[model samples]
Target: MKDIFSTIKIQVNEKIYVKDPETSALGRKIIQESILLMEEIGFDNFTFKKLGTKINSNESSIYRYFENKHKLLLYLSSWYWSWIEYKLFFATTNVDDSFEKLKKAITVVTEKIVDDKATAHINEAVLNKIIISEYTKTFHTKEVDEENKEGYFLIYKRVINRIVKLITEVNPEYPFAKSLASTIIEGSLHQHFLRDHLKTITNCDEHVSPTDFYINLIITVLKK
Candidate 1:
């Protein structure tokens, strides 16, 4: 039999999921339905049994792919970070100007996501909402230290590292490149949530888009 896992396009680390959800129909169903179930019902009420029922599969079948719901969330979040890094890579690669490259990369993260069909099982749009609301839970848990040691955050680290490199290229003397990189990524995620749900608290002005605010902030700080 041909190996389906080998053909799966997205390069999420094996540490994220118990099994590669892309390798089999049941696994794919687990990921596809879990995203909708998590988004619709909220992660607090989402469960393996509920997801299984939604997919017409059993709880154990879903467990074959993910250890538990937290792992499932981690898997989705990892996939998203990996997807973001891919978007950043392609978006900035052809640009010769360092400032333009930096601005373009910022746009990729801060701008609203359009539906991407390349990774069909995971709805990037819905998943972004889930990430905004639930991604922190994956890292803020008691087991986070253990998970971090396992390279569970490689995709996020990869994305931050790339941004840090770009910042260094633009401002070689910047002492806080990595710190600024993380601030942009994490702060942008939270700012996005605030902009949508608690508009008054966000740093963004009504006249400027969220992407504009983030791009301008980074440019002002780094383009010395």
Candidate 2:
């Protein structure tokens, strides 16, 4: 019964930020309130100037941490995937059945996020809203290749890698483990986004559980 988060660190790459937002009060406030404000206004309209105003600080102060909102988004995304990877590991660690482990991982990612008091400084539930709403923007840029080389996405890569391993465990002969794993991860989150906006386009029904469709999706493909 080890407290997994207590023993692990969510490492956002140094290249992504000028200051580690976890280090100081102002830094932590910037992260905490940034998650709040991003959820409130959406990432496209979010600005350090507005954030500074809300936090009662100078806009220039945000640069002491992030170079710009793009990098900030990446930092938030990295933290999220790190948290997710931890959760997936924690959720499935003792399961003997590979397919069951994979199902649990899918549920952890595709389902609702609950606030964990262990990391009270962060409201992961609100952060998941931003993540589901905006995570793709973190890499849909010209600099993605260079940033990839800097190891800016290792945690994200690791999550996929872990899922891929589970996929292989379930069907050692399967040739599409990586592809299927990525599809489950990205497709499930994308469906969650659609559930909020174009509910008609989504297969998930709230009364049945937000994760039901996605869990069925991966299980069907993996078991087949």
Candidate 3:
């Protein structure tokens, strides 16, 4: 199998269109506009026709960029992961202290989850159900294509692995480092979906900021 980084690099480098610059620009525009629409109407209600109409293009033209809604969604999901990875990498790079680095890592991940623009389009309750159903179904109902799996793992899973490694390195006695790291990461994601209820549950009258909460939680756990 191709190395994941190499594969992404190649995909990024490959020219999507060889002949028409105008067509290539239009194709990219369609995907960008579609992403914005998805952030507005959501994936279930969003359609190629609506996207084309929004962008003042014909429905047929969208096929030049995405073969179908699924493909377009896949690209959008990948883009989100890629964006998070870039932010995490940059945020953690300059921190020399292992504990500080780990805190920074959690902060970056939590902030991305709490980003307003990214979360605006989807109704949290319905979106969470769809995500859980689709993710669980992906493992069983569909064959796990190695290339796609690698691409996804690279963009998403690797970030968590790096954080876990950092946690273990900072304090080897940190019991259940792997499990705790997963908790911190996944908990932050779940918190975003349950933000309103969580605020009420925790008796925090104001919105609970994930970054501050995650950093504080990690520090408390590590000091214990």
- Top-lDDT candidate index: 2
Worst 10 residues of 1 by lDDT: 1-10
Model 1, span 1-224: residue lDDT tens: 01432244777778767789988988887888899999999999999998888998878988888888988998899988888887888789879999889889888887777667666677889999998889889899898898899999888899999999998888999999999889888887888888888988876655666788878787789877
Predicted candidate 3, C-alpha RMSD: 7.4
TM-scores of the models, in the order given: 0.92, 0.94, 0.68
Q: lDDT at 143 for candidate 2?
A: 89
Alpha-carbon error at 172 in model 1, in Å? 0.8
Report the Cα lDDT for residue 127, model 2: 93
Ranking the candidates on lDDT from highest down gives: 2, 1, 3
Query: In candidate 2, how many Å is residue 167 off?
Result: 0.6
Which portions of model 3 show Cα errors greater than 4 Å?
A: 1-23, 112-150, 196-207
Top-TM-score structure, candidate number: 2
Clash pairs for candidate 2: none
lDDT tens digits, residues 103-149, model 2? 88878877888876677678899999898899889888898999999
lDDT of 1: 0.84
Candidate 2 Cα misplacement greater than 4 A, ranges: 1-3
Cα lDDT tens digits, model 3, 1-224, are 11333224212211222222123567557655665676567666879899989989899877766666665655444444555566677678878988888877887766633332333332333433333223323233253465345453355466677788888878888778878877776676666546644455542234557667877777787864
Instruction: Estimate the lDDT of model 2.
Output: 0.86
The TM-score measured for candidate 1 stands at 0.92
